[model samples]
Target: MYFTFRQVQYFVLTAELGTISGAATAARISQSAITESIRQLEEQVGSALFSRHARGIALTYEGHRFLRHAKLIISTVKDAEDAFTAKNDNVAGNLRLGVTNLVAGYFLSDILARFRRVFPEVSVEVVEDHRRYIEHLLISGELQLALMVISNIEEQFALSVDPLMRSRFRVWVSPKNDLADKSRVKSSDLRDQKLILLANEDLLESISGWLQGEELIDQVFLRTTSVEAVRSLVGTNTGVAIMPDLAFRPYTLEGDRLEARPVEGLSVTLDVGLVWRQGSPDTDQAEIFKTVARDYHSKR
Candidate 1:
């Protein structure tokens, strides 16, 4: 009942990393400090949040239930802080934005929601397209700003990019799959496994580049652009998927659980960010949105 935000933050990180040492390393604190925070949080909640094992810890049922509330608490605190500091009550303008399909589904909504809340008077028009077409629109000045996967931008030199977040790729497996119990999965481990690949060109290209020479091409069982389809297939034990953590969900729409495991040899990350034409004059709307996005990602 008296736990601090720091405790909740530590709790969340510990839950995410599944190890006190990993959370400590991420938080730049001592392992004992991370342990204490989790202990205090568990005490405050009056339940055991994690089941400890030789490898690491896993969330107890109570912990999984509490994780949702903990994340909401952090989000609510961030929104409240942003609301208090916002100075754009009188700002009003129309803004044109472009987004890739993957980004539009995962990252755009939260940022757009925050932007709208901060600048309620501003009208926003969003265009969702493939990354190439979005880049064309950005270069043509048809779009003032774009939220996209900036990792493989074809026009990198022609655009100015502000990376918001980097999400590393992980192998998604059904809870019942043999790979789900593994701490880390190697590309070789997936060579014979059925794969459910996302059909987005950018994602496919990135995945292909990393997974090259792994003999996975012939193992790909299905290719679809739908993230949910991939989730469902992976959750139902149809196949495993290697995807960025940004788009990961623990459960499918049908409530089948999925697990994400780090890839041993995969070092690629999906970088999503704001992009604009390099030489174009930054409009007031663009600058304002950038500031909000910067602030939003900074807190995360």
Candidate 2:
């Protein structure tokens, strides 16, 4: 039986979100449309795709069987679209990019500057968010590409990741603060001090693990999701924050209101990189952007 792409998309969205309403919102369609589409699809298959429960829906056995193939079909369609779009030399197309704050602070401007110079007609849009959210966007086709801290990516199975540059973490505080005299503060030294950090779950978990190893888990004071918030909090001398050095340089040097010192044995540095769906089209503009990013970082 022939299955349409829309049917698979509706089916997958419903399955993933576990409710027709949720799926409709995600797919940007009305609930009745998704309901009818799924009904038609189930009729074609002659088996129950989902079992409706009080809370939501669960995939039936037949649904599980079809989902794997459905994902492949969607991926193939996306690859075809990317390939066709990548054919243009002028790069006169929309490029949706997702980036974390650090990438936005350090790498984005240079990349955008170079890309704009090369492809003035190309429209570029950027969404700044944490790593997890960006990855979600990449998988959902909401973002064409993303730049993030690479230490968070555990596997490269379905992604093409290109190493852009390496950066390390450091403990930041107002230079006038008492800790500035030390070359590097130890984990134990931080125990009595109020610690601030970008409220990333993975980063928090990583720090928690390190603190636990050092038996200093109870010392954190402020945890925020915004890096700018961390900076503002730290700038006000509310607490000391640990952040990637790349992001703190400008503020540390120019803001005279704050300072950052190396934290010895903290092991918080990160390798920043770019990621896109594996097997996506590689166009000349994309290649040029990579080259420009590498060259720009190399000089710094």
Candidate 3:
């Protein structure tokens, strides 16, 4: 047999008050609601909990026995809720987090700085890698949190994701590139053009899957693991690349300017945010870091 918390609450209150009307008064609910809950609870247990009287009610032997267990259950639930809700003075703990290479370069510095200022006692350990690897570490419980591009996060983690920012996906082209004169470019416009991709093999594979229908994908000139290489290629008119607007720098290391054109006819965006395992609640130290990240985005 199964019962609900509300049913248990009504059973306990009715037992204490000895009357449905009195229970309703105590619970701030309709008298009929209290009666229904008690009836359902008794149905589950397959026994009448109380014997009716002219004035009120009296607990049967079964009622007395169940009352003890009911109180224990209620108390345990209260303790569990308190554990999650209660404020703790000690926020000192090691915060283990993961970030992708892109997030580490463009997003993590501000959040980490704010977190350190607020929770100096908390030690932070971070790992930076490709998004897929970061998610792997997170799901394996090797990381407490992951600050990465939260859009379309792999379902296997069953994570609790809170979006912090949405950065527009843009294409970086050289001034000499034909698209440089236009304010925007389309996926189809990439045809016959050499492209530079910055990612690990898995990411490249994913991008390739999406672009498989496009024949120009064969012309992907450089498959570099370095972001700098992508920037240098785009700046020197060597090739064009697509990335988030957060990564756009007008000038490269060699002082050559790069052109960023928004991608049209597509809903592509980088949804950056904090992600933690669902049901596995964050510790106080990690909670502080999450708050800092949230506040940093809100301010921006």
Candidate 4:
């Protein structure tokens, strides 16, 4: 009889994840229940929101138009909740942002640009650091919020982590590499090849933990803190690097082409998102910025 907040949330999650099952898993609901919610939502709205495909679902023209309203509703309601529990700082205040090196290079610009366009009056200061250091800043109240890898956070219970995207690491190689032409690459395949490792400790640890199964952590040829350096090495066929989709590119600065293929047996995922102290009150500015980040990630 009415469009409830639960229906709106279900609709938005389905649109974001592009499947009922995905929405279910992400929201900790059942697939049938999600389906029924979408069905009731469509009935109440008097339009088909999604076009079903063999693989997944896609928003219809009307669905795309409605998505804006859904996000606005969700964000507005969440902001209202934040107002009661958190400091009601005006949207015009300065936002202290902590970003990790990997996120700063790969994902921060787009989020910052869109956020600036929407909240131009909000001043933003970003501190780029390692994941642990960023978390430290978040914990110490130096940062209002942070965008970083949340997959393996040491103190997860102390922070509120909202994941924006899942980035799984894979092998990156120059087109000239011997395995470049193969349909798939495996851990054993990379054991003998030269490896260029990113110097980010968390990433280094994730990559090492997986490759340790093959006893191949010692295969590293060069280690650098710069993602571009890893790219250059892989592009020039100097060494193969393993990195997540967030920072992986098919080309280097010199315009040399590269390739990325999934590792046959690796299951590590880098989930990046916003984090703040669990007990700390979020500023209004932080709430709005989080909305901007979510919208950007949803579109991608």
Candidate 5:
């Protein structure tokens, strides 16, 4: 079965938005266009990708399987384009950047890799620290740019934020846990459950706000600074966790499966992107890096 790149893009978008209309709106095309694209894609694959419902649609088992392949195809195509585009630009210089611990691990690596490929002569120095410290580095002119979670940035008036992506918080559980079967786990559902919290200051503050009340706070089992530790502990059913979907993985390092489900009353999302001093003149290297990072995320 043959399908164009556009078809795969449409399928992935529709799967993510969970509705043809929403995908069409996001893609800036008509709903009929999205429907036809999905219909042709389903014909090509010889299976229904989504199940229609009153509110919207849900991915079928086949759709879930196909979504993974679709995302890989998109990422592969974007990488190729990035590599080709980078070869055309020869701008190079030292770029001093700052990053928080969470953003460094989850988001910065891919952007840095693409940037280096494009500007091989550029020396990239990264300082990893807490979000507040990263912001301080940016403000003090010690860093040219910072990639961090911008949702809780304190000195917003002093910095310019260029947002790349926003990821929602979700409840993560082991497949053996009862919450794994839930379509949406409410905050109240976690009141009595043992909870594993990540030790990032920003995440801790947000979670603390959401999980208010003595009963919920008292349910905290342990707090750690390692993302992998949270994954492993949750995978072994030691405790479930609520974290940003951006850092989520289906399986632990030890090969145990984990599941993420939507939180019913959670409307907060983690915004990650680039931040720079408001009036600082952009150097050639800093400008190029920012462009590359923004383009990379926009494609994704």
Candidate 6:
């Protein structure tokens, strides 16, 4: 037969207090009941847990070994109870969040910091992945929420997407490059400039569509993925790149070496949003996060 939780509790208490009377006192039970429970536990385990000493009980070697596992079980149970209580009544529990590097680099820090300030007990785990993988994980229930590139979202999936901000890509180049002097660059002006593009192929396709609509497709150049690579390449005058305005910030890299300007006759913008699975129960923590994001965007 297996030992009951109460029996394990009694045994652990007896081991800790080193006396049946002390264990009973701490557990608010009678000494006889504590002793009987410990006895039953010993019988179930088929081993002696305590040995009588001069004034109290001492653990046998087996008891010390069993004590560790018992403590783990107790701790796990307590943690579950605490998590349940916090989820139901407090905006404090474990949150599994996913964020793309782009999103985390730009927006997540402020939102998380504000959240920590308000709900100090809430534990947050952030998984940073590319936008595509992060979105897949979020839909699979592996993540509670995610900050992703809505420009890359597929319309076939049923997801609750909330637009947080709208931003456009600006072509970045060395400030000293010839293009820096132009008020606006035409689509055909990029014919000779090497180009770098970030992930989110759909956005790139949208840009292509815009270019095609304006009858300017054959003028395209090289496309690279790494934003850092783009920055380095542009800093060294290797090529120009298109990056989100919020992501590019101040249009300088390591110094006032790089500049970003709008290309003329092109009106391409992407909406970034918060995505979560539909029909999930709204927790206070989720609400807190939502409010923080909305308020943060409203101020910007």
Off by over 4 Å in 5: 1-90, 213-215
Misplaced by over 4 Å in model 1 are 1-74
Question: How do the candidates rank by TM-score, highest first?
Answer: 1, 5, 4, 3, 6, 2
lDDT, residue 182, candidate 1: 92
Q: Write the per-residue lDDT of candidate 5 for residues 1-300, one digit (tens) a residue.
A: 899999999999999888888999999999999999999999999999889989999887678778878987877677677667555466677999998878898888778977776677899999999998899989999999998889899999999999999989998999899898888988788886899989888688667777774357778889999999999999999999989998987778787878999988788788899999999998988898889888878866
Model 3 lDDT, full chain set: 0.77
**CA RMSD of all predictions:** 4.1, 18.7, 22.2, 9.7, 5.3, 21.7
**TM-scores, in order shown?**
0.79, 0.61, 0.64, 0.69, 0.74, 0.62
Residue 201 in model 4: lDDT: 71
lDDT accuracy of residue 107 in candidate 5: 88
lDDT tens digits, residue span 1-300, model 4: 579999999999999888889999999989999999999999999999899999999887678767868987776675456455543344687999998777887889867866665566789999998888888888999999998878778878889999999999888999899989888898888977999888887687667777777787789878898888888889899999889998875567776777898888788987788999999986888998898799778866
Q: Which ten residues in a row have the lowest lDDT in candidate 2?
A: 249-258
TM-score of model 5 (CA atoms):
0.74
Clashes of 4: 0
Off by over 4 Å in 4: 1-90
* Regions of model 3 farther than 4 Å from truth: 1-90, 201-206
**Candidate 5: clashing pairs of residues:** none
The residue-by-residue lDDT of candidate 1 on 34-119, one tens digit each, is 89888888899899999999999988767877896898678767777777787776778889999988888888777787778667
Which candidate leads in TM-score? 1
Q: After superposition, how far is residue 150 of candidate 5 from its true place, in Å?
A: 0.7
lDDT score, candidate 6: 0.72
- lDDT digits (tens) for residues 154-261 of candidate 2: 546867798877666778886656787788887677876788867675456446666678776566776787777787777767788877766663242224355678
State model 4's lDDT: 0.84
What would the per-residue lDDT of candidate 6 be over residues 92-135, giving only the tens digit for each residue? Answer: 78778887666777778766765665567778898988767777
Taking the tens digit of each residue's C-alpha lDDT, what string does model 3 give over 151-170?
65775447788889988757
